[model samples]
Target: MHFHGTEVRQQALTLLRGGSENAEVARRLNVPLGTISYWKHVDRAKRGEPVATRPSLLCPLCHRRPLDDSAYAYLLGLYLGDGHISHYAKHHVPSLAITLDDGWPGIQDQAETALRAVFPHNATCRVRTKGAHNIKVYFKHLPCLFPQHGPGKKHDRKIALEPWQQEIVDAHPWDFVRGLIHSDGCRITNWTTRLVRGERKRYEYPRYFFTNKSDDIRELFTDTLDKLGITWTHCTRNGNPFNISVARKASVALMDTHIGPKY
Candidate 1:
């Protein structure tokens, strides 16, 4: 009566979704027919259940496939910022969910687009909730791709990238920055009044702010900024160092050209 619970369930789910009959799934996975039925019942979520996917091709680590590093890097930043990877004790498969504000449909589109680009073999779907669209995908290799996936909130633990992931970020720094900004950062105008030759004038300048509770995440942001020759400062409010501001004129100009306000 004992079968590989996790692996068998995953294969069974794939087979069932791929148009295989229950008997066939039980045979292929060497699982009992009644167990397969029970599994299917539990497998479905409220909305948009995922179809079968060949993880070998979809997974960069499991097979020798060409992965879209640029998209991966961008998605990584978003994941570190506002994304969550969840798992159930019984289910082996892990789900990657990125919470994006519904206000900006364009950014949500880009997020889903990037997700599909990286895992072209898998089906990506979005679920709408109050004022936000949760972009999500299911895959076995998600943890392999985003090694930062672990128990507890990211800010509660250390967050660092693997060497290979770092290479991707280094190659596509702007994309990474844009992803972080899109998720946890914003660009706003700051105005001030100055006296110019006995005349009062108002000056407005655009500045970008990236706020995250994780210290390691903020450090990664500043390190990348250094590589891009972008000037940034650590902003503290009420004795907490959790905000990074790109307010310098030249840096803000660079941010405008590359990572403008998310529309």
Candidate 2:
């Protein structure tokens, strides 16, 4: 008798548990109906749960599985900066979506790559809008990876990472910083003419600015910067410290090394 691999079986179980009908799951996964039914039976028996089953093996939060270090770190930063985890009515699985500027196709590719790396079994896609692209993927366990998903907007709620997430960011700090910079931050050069010994010379300043409304999110960004030995300051916007600026030459050099521009 031919049998599906364990990964395929686990994927089928997840789809079946996510309110998908037997025939739909079978068709979507290209698995035989009889095999799908058998997998469901075994999963139900093992879990001792009703129709709705627990998260499949892909959920690191539920299964204590190890995540792709660089991918998770980068995705976490993007999530806190500009990404959103959308909730829906019952029976509809949640989605993790990160909005990227269309001008930077490279960043879009990176976001898609990170999504695929994080959820190798799930499908990733991109939706184009007026001036940007939303790279998203549907997964029932998105909330398991990003615990910060909540009822209100990210800026309106407190954003904090779980211990395990923090560990990944600590390990791959550069990737995390790159994600944040590519999302809500930017690198620009400001030039001013200065008087030299003979003729006027143009003086230029290169700096990075990360803007986010949530205090907790800003703190998280700064905390990561401190660990990386990067200096930053609170750049006041509308009379409030809403933007984190890394303008020091040494720190800016370090940031340029890891994350130049959005491109």
Best by lDDT: 1
What tens digits encode model 2's per-residue C-alpha lDDT throughout 220-244? 8899999999999988867867899
Per-prediction TM-score to the true structure, in the order listed = 0.78, 0.78
Model 1 C-alpha lDDT per residue in residues 82-161, reported as the tens digit of each score:
89988865647788899999888889999999999998877889988889989998887788888898888999999999
Per-residue error for 223 in candidate 2, Å, reads: 1.1
Each model's lDDT comes to 0.88, 0.86
Error of 2 at 221 (Å): 0.9
Which regions of candidate 2 are displaced past 4 Å?
1-57, 198-200, 237-240
Model 2: lowest-lDDT 10 consecutive positions:
49-58
